[model samples]
Target: MLLHIDSSADTTADSVTRQLTEAFARTWHTAHGNSADHRHRDLSAAPVPPITPAYTTLGRRVEREGFVPPAKVPALTESAAEQREWGLTLPYITELLAADTLLLGVPMYNFAVPATLKAWIDRVTFPGALTDPDTGESLLRHTRVIAVMARGGGYGPGTPREHFDFQTPYLKAYFGSLGVPPENLHLVAAELTRVDVLPQLAGLEELAADSLARARATLTALAAA
Candidate 1:
C-alpha cells in the first residue's frame, strides 16, 4: 500500500503544491488501478497533536527499554492491556511500518517545513521504533519515500537560497535514519516565486509539465520494481 500525506495548509482552489500532489495521486492510481491501495492523511485539514510531555515520556521509556510506562497505562482504558499499553506515538509508527511507499506533499514555510509536518515527523522518529537501540539498524526496512515540495523562491542547486532549503535535507536525514537509502528518496520541487514576473501561461505549463513528468517516471519505476 501507498501512504499519501499532504501537509499544505493552503485551501485556495489553485494551490500549486496541493494541485500537483493530487494530480500525482490521480495519475498513479490511474496507472496502477487495484494493484495498489492508497491510504491518505491530510495534515493541514485534520492536524494531529504535537508531541506532548506525556507522549515524550512514553516514547523515552519505549526507546530505552522497549516498554511503556506504567503511569500512562491506565490512560488506555478502552482496549486490551496488551494492545493499548504503548506510547501515544506507536500508532503513527505502525502506520509507517504498514506502508510500502510514502508520498509527502509539503510546502516550504519560512524556508522550512510547516509545523504540522514537523509534528508528524516527531511522531514517527522514535528511537528503537524506527531505528535500533544498539547497532542503530533501521526498523523500517526497504520502504521508499517521494517528497513533492513547493517554495515561494527558487532554491535549486547553486542558488543563493539553496542553503536555506532545509526541508529536503532534514527529510532525507530523518528517513535515512529509519533505513531508507538515498536512492529511494525522490524529490520534486516547484519554484513558484520565479513565475511571478513571467506570469505567462507557457512558463506555468512548462513547470507543471516538468514536475508531472518527473513524478510519473518515478512512480512508474517504483511500481514496476
Candidate 2:
C-alpha cells in the first residue's frame, strides 16, 4: 500500500506540489489498478495535533521501557491525558509502518517545510515507532519515498540561492534517519513558481515552466517505477 501525504497550505489549483503529487497518485493508480492500495492524508485540511508535554513524556517512557502495541499504551501510563494524546498520534505512526510507499506533497514555506508537516513529523517520529525495539531494525528501510516540492525561488545547483534550499536537505535527512536509503528516496522540485505573478521575476517564467515540466515528467516516470 502507498500513503499519499499532502502538506500544501494552498488550494490544489494554486499549489504546484499538490498538482505533482496528485498526478503521481493518478499515474500510480492507473499503473497498479487493483493490485495496490492507496491512501491519502491531507495535513493541511485536517492537521495533525501538536505534540503536547504529556505526549512527549509518554513517548519517552515507552522508549525507555521498550515498545508496546498502541492498544497496550494505557498499561504503560496511568494518566488519562497521556493515553489520550498517544491515541491521537499513534495512528500516524501506524500508517507509516504499514505503508510500502510514502508520497509527500511538500512546499517550501520560509525555505522549509510547512509547520503542519513538521507537526506531523514530530508526532510520528518517536523512538521505537519507526524503528524496531527488539531488533533495532528500521521499519522504513524498504519503504519508497517521493517528495514533490515547490519553491518560490530558484535554489538548484549553482543558483545564487542554492544554499538556501533547506527543504530538500532537511527531508533527505529526516527520511535517512528512518532508514530510507538514498536510492529509495526520489525528489522532484518545481522552483521559482512565483515568477509569473511577480514583476521582479518576469523574465524567469521560462525557467519556472521548464522546471515544472521536468518535475511532472519525473513524477510520471517515478510513479510507474
- Tell me the lDDT of model 2 at 142: 94
Show the lowest summed lDDT stretch of 10 residues, model 1. 76-85
Task: In angstroms, give how far residue 73 of model 2 lies from its true place.
Answer: 3.2
The top-ranked prediction according to TM-score is 2
Residue 192's lDDT within candidate 1 is 50
Write candidate 2's Cα lDDT for 1-225 as tens digits. Answer: 889999999965888988899899999988899568899999999999888989888888887877665666778775989878878888898898899889999999999999999999999987577776668788889999999999988998898888998999899999998889899999889999999778877899889999999999999999988
Clash count (model 2, backbone only): 0
Question: What range of 10 consecutive residues in model 2 has the weakest lDDT sum?
Answer: 65-74
Model 1 stretches with alpha carbons more than 4 Å out: 66-88, 132-136, 197-225
For candidate 1, give the lDDT of residue 109. Answer: 94
Clashing pairs in 1: none
Over the full model, what C-alpha lDDT does candidate 1 score relative to the true structure? 0.70
